[model samples]
Target: MSLAFSERARAEIDRLLARYPTRGAATLPVLRVAEREFGGIDDDVMVLVADTLDLSPAQVRGVFSFYTHLRRPGWGKYVLQVCATLSCALRGCEGLADHLEARLGIRAGQTTPDRRFTLLKVECLARCGESPVLQVNDDMYVNVTPAKADAILESLP
Candidate 1:
């Protein structure tokens, strides 16, 4: 299939490409633009990004798979990733994860039916001192508890 990027995406890709010395070097940023434009990264999205960056579909897919933090297809508006590292686990992250699952009515790695929240168990957020960190979209909430997590969700628009 012939894929076409939106004008804004094309312009943004061009701008990102200009910052890099090689197309390969521009792959990640171009893929970010694609991710925002396409909603989430999938095979078709990889193909479009590959063509834009002059890389192979395999190359784009490889990068996407390697970066687990990037949004995936079916991800909800709020991607809730609770840190599951040793420090976090020792600090009741498991309970926090369970609470999130129960509250959202979906297990970790699943999105709610309404697509408002996707719960995931992720690695360290590097704030070990503040264990039980929860990342919602791009924001990180350190020292998170079940109650605080619920409050955070309610605060979203």
Candidate 2:
């Protein structure tokens, strides 16, 4: 089957593209829009994004693969990105990741069977002072301990 953005999504992407001087310059936002529209960037969606932005599919895939924050196919309702940078590692981020893995029953880079949560070990949340940090979707959780992580999971709807 083919992929296409809704009219509203197209209009939104067009508006965003207008802000940039060239379509190539608007790649990231366009990918974001495509990700949201096509329900995460798979091969077909990448082609759609490339055609929309006048970019190569490889170019679109490059940007998508570079950003761990971007969702992919089979991602769950909540994406748990645990920082694995030096600062976070120093603050017991490894234990935090272990806790999440055991609790979610999935290893890093894997999604839960129920698709409620997907665990990941990433670079940084840009909150070094907080040390151990976890990013749930667009929201950041600083100073996250195993206990705090449980509470955070409970807080999710």
Candidate 3:
């Protein structure tokens, strides 16, 4: 069976399609809707998105893979994406990634077994000055040391 969007997502897709001249132009927005509605963009959602946009699965997959914000399975309740770029790396973000992996008991790019956290080492987070930055889902935590990271993780419910 083909995957389907929820009513809310359908409405949003309709609005997006109206804004763009072609259905393909709405692919990214539609993908975001699917991600929000389904929690992540898995294989099934990729097919659905391709069908919705009148594009091939390869096309949708290409776009999906290009953006780090769009996630796949193994996503946890909180996704911690740390900057691995030069600025953050020079500021000791690698140690931060290691610290989180040890503390969460999952290596980078893996989700905790309990489904509570996922640690990912990403390229830039756009706050080079705030090196050692990581984004927990949409909210960014800048200047994160190991202690501060632990405290932040502990504070999450």
Candidate 4:
């Protein structure tokens, strides 16, 4: 079965495409819209997007696989992506990650039992100066200590 977008999603996709000179360049935004509407980018959604944008399935899938933001499977409401690069590692990110795991009872790459959050060990959040950076949903938190991380997680709804 092919994926279909809600009227609101279609309007958002149109607005997103208008920002780019070429519709093809709006693939990322379209994918995000599809993901938000359908909850994830399945094979059917890829084809649907390709059809909507006049691209091929191969083209859609290529771009989808290249971007980490395009999720192939559904995730929890909160996605906690910790920077695991050298700088972040040196700043005690691993310890913070351990604390998160212990407190949430879910390891990296897993979701909480209540399905409220997912912890991901990501490559780099591009905050070297603010080592030990993490992105929760769309917000970035930097210079995180275990205590700060605990407080952040505790504050989540």
For each candidate, the alpha-carbon lDDT, in order, equals 0.88, 0.90, 0.89, 0.86
Task: Give the TM-score of each candidate.
Answer: 0.88, 0.93, 0.92, 0.84
Which one is best on TM-score? 2
lDDT of 3 at 57: 97
**How far is each candidate from the true structure, as Cα RMSD in Å?**
1.8, 1.4, 1.5, 2.2
lDDT (10s digit) by residue, model 3, range 1-157: 5579888788889999999998998888899899888878898999998988899999999999877888786688899999999999999999999899888888899988888888899988899998899899888999999999999988998
Instruction: Write model 2 residue lDDT over 26-53, tens digit each, in one string.
Output: 8889888888887788888888889989
Worst 10 residues of 1 by lDDT: 64-73
Tell me the lDDT of model 1 at 57. 92
How should the candidates be ordered by TM-score, best one leading?
Answer: 2, 3, 1, 4
The segments of candidate 4 whose C-alpha lies over 4 angstroms from its true place after superposition are: 70-73
Candidate 3 lDDT trough over 10 residues, lowest sum: 65-74
Compute the lDDT of residue 114 as modeled in candidate 4.
76
Q: Which digits, one per residue and each the tens of the lDDT, describe model 4 over residues 29-144?
A: 89988987888898999999998898999999999976656665657778988888899999999998888888889889998877788898888788999989988988899999
- Candidate 2 has a TM-score of 0.93
Instruction: Name the lDDT of candidate 2.
Output: 0.90
lDDT of 1 by residue, 29-127 (tens): 887887788778888889988887888999988988766578888899889989998999999999999999999999999999998999999878888
Sorted on lDDT, best first, the list reads 2, 3, 1, 4
